[model samples]
Target chain A: MAPLEPWEKVLISADFTQSIHGRAGCVACHRGQQSPDKDTAHVGLIPDPSQDAQRVCGVCHGEIVDGFGTSLHASLQGYRTIVYSRSVPENHPALDTAMQNHCLSCHTTCGDCHISQPKPVGGGLLNGHNVEKTPSMTRVCTACHGSRVGAEYLGKHEGIPGDVHFREGRMNCMACHAGTDLHAAEGDAAKHRYWGDQQPACKDCHAQVGRADDPIPQHTIHGNKLACQVCHAVEYTSCDGCHVAISEKTGNPFFKTEATYLSFVIGHNPWPSRERPYEYVVLRHAPVAPTTFEYYGENLLPNFGLLPTWTYATPHNIQRQTPQNRSCNTCHGNAALFLTADKVKSEELEANRRVIVENIPAAIPIP
Target chain B: MRRVGMLLLILGVGVFLGACASQGISTPTPVPTAPLPEAVLTPLSQTDYCVQCHTDKEALIETAKPEEKAPSESEGVG
Candidate 1:
């Protein structure tokens, strides 16, 4: 991480005319003590005012705040499903402690995405806490999401160029992923984030891709049978294994994920939808090892194999012409490009059985 | 040997003079230089009060990084 810019450097530098937060007094949201004395004023000051936005921001922007509460950003139910599925009961003392101390820290609050740098990035004011309708991409989104998605989107990993949309069109994340999508959540508790209809789809913006007149024959031929990312996306970094456990030395919980490697594969879609009723989608190996939470207890997750280790993923490193699109042989005869048993770890074979494509078709040129 | 000693003495004297000249120990003309501007610390946010305490928090985080945490006991176990 780079040294933060001196406060003096950004102070009174940027325009705050349009900033909603600029008008609101700091003490209004961050209630503590306010005095000239450092300790007196700082005591009990909310470092992240967004965490308690229900009480703080809701008073002013009721409907927006209400929508934000159930939003995927707030509830993080999708992440909860993944964690709880592989660990002891959510209420387990050790699990609860870790969730509060470590895991939940990654949880986004309003200020995280809007005003200050995310806590994960060592929180500080971005542009003197000048609130924007579209927050700073590096300070806000990439601060937390930097490991994989950020790297792919920004072309920072493995010398890969940025996503074509961003590189060529100069479009930002908010262009496709609407504010409504980030601030709203609809459906039942059982609904995994993938099941949500509001989830961003390529067809939502690029409706021409799979249309009858589209130049790419593969698009119509494959249709919903293949996800857009599978062909259009370049190789992306993937984390093979992860382990979360309490450190014996410090007794404080720690999280570790395996070394990153770049690979792309087409696998069975975990959850199919109307827009993306794909039989095969891009699969990025997750950071979840079989023994991710075993330190908490023995056999905490008896059915670790219930879900594939290679889950459906949307690598944002999109390109108009990927290796797959160049020639039929890139994918047709390439068993390596498909999630097969041999490609996965021996332990994960069972979990990934459904996703593994047994035989790849021989290269056949399109006339 | 006497000639070599004389040469060495002269070389040493020359080197010392060169070193002094490089270091600006002696100048033909002493130019009065203006003092460099000092940095003024300004608040990046309206909440300068908040930053005062948070600066300590940043220092604490930096210290925490060097402290090694134990790796999980059950890693890579079947």
Candidate 2:
């Protein structure tokens, strides 16, 4: 997406000044002097007042602010869960420094979504400070989640069609992930995104799936054995070996990943709990290594091998029919499509053992 | 010593009378009025200074700097 011009970013429309939010006046939230002089007026101005949501937005939106403390977007508990898993308490200082330098910039605020494009994408008002109840799919959500989820959902990847929900149904992220889910009060205890029940699950809308009387024989046959994405999702990007550091020359934080390639591999369920009880699920290679935080300090992630580099995934490039489910023989006995012993890197073998399939299903005999 | 004592007594009487006369002649305290009720100012009650300059497209264009491409790192790590 093209960045908004400086003039375009701050231009408030005449119509907006008459709206409910606009009527509150800029100084009511922004808290700057009402002087005519630019320098004098901006003496104590807050560029993005919603950063302190409770104090600014809370005057009217108290209920939302009350629950926002636990929201995944605000707490960033998922990132902390993954990073903390690979480090000991003693090394947390260095790991935290690395996160501050490299990760926390993606930390979002209320205004980041409702008012403007995210800061990660060079913030500008979406429409002259007019607050949008539903954020723009192209500008707000995808602006940050662009690399994988956004790419797959929007079909930005070369030759790959966009998700069926997007291409056919025209469903936005909010269509499935409602405001309640995003601002969930239950999010405080969540270790990761997949911590609880499969939210916005395929079964939620497609309730006929996996039922005994279901028309699709494959759904019944594969009941509780395979994840929906395992058969429905097409190829998605998998990354490897991401290292982070503060650039000595520029004094800016930077990261480099070894490679990113398209792959569709099914692996044993890493976490088969009550919510996600599938025996098999799609997996993606995460961009992490023991030396990822070396720039912060040596051996920062001494327990890196404790967590697998290849983690459970639900690719957004879903289709009604995919190559994996083309026929019985396509996925069965297909070693290439399975995360077998040979598929994992030699160094990652130990970490990924639980998720690696030990035996491939035999191919059905041709009648 | 008696004369000095008499003079000191006169000075003390004069100082006391002067203080009394000053207080009597001073302006009488005005009657206190009820404190004004807190006004219930509505939203957008005040003139928004931020909107004033920001809405001026010509001024913004004049001050606009050349756009610089965002760094790759800002694109984010997986």
Model 2 misses residue A117 by how many Å?
0.3
Query: Per-residue lDDT of A230-261 in model 2, one digit per residue for the tens?
Result: 99999999998889987776778888888889
**Top-TM-score structure, candidate number:** 2
Residues A263-318 of candidate 1 have per-residue lDDT tens digits of 87888887676745888888888777766666765665666788888887889899
Docking class of 1: incorrect
Report the lDDT of model 2 for residue A106: 86
- List clashing residue pairs in candidate 2: none
Compute each candidate's TM-score over C-alphas: 0.77, 0.87
Q: Is the docking of candidate 2 incorrect, acceptable, medium or high quality?
A: acceptable
Candidate 1 residues lying further than 4 Å off, grouped into runs, are A5-20, A86-94, A188-191, A248-251, A365-367, B1-78
Best by lDDT: 2
Reference-based lDDT, each prediction = 0.72, 0.86
Candidate by candidate, in order, the iRMS in Å equals: 9.0, 3.3
Q: What is the lDDT of residue B9 in candidate 1?
A: 100
DockQ of every model listed? Answer: 0.04, 0.24
Candidate 1 docking DockQ = 0.04
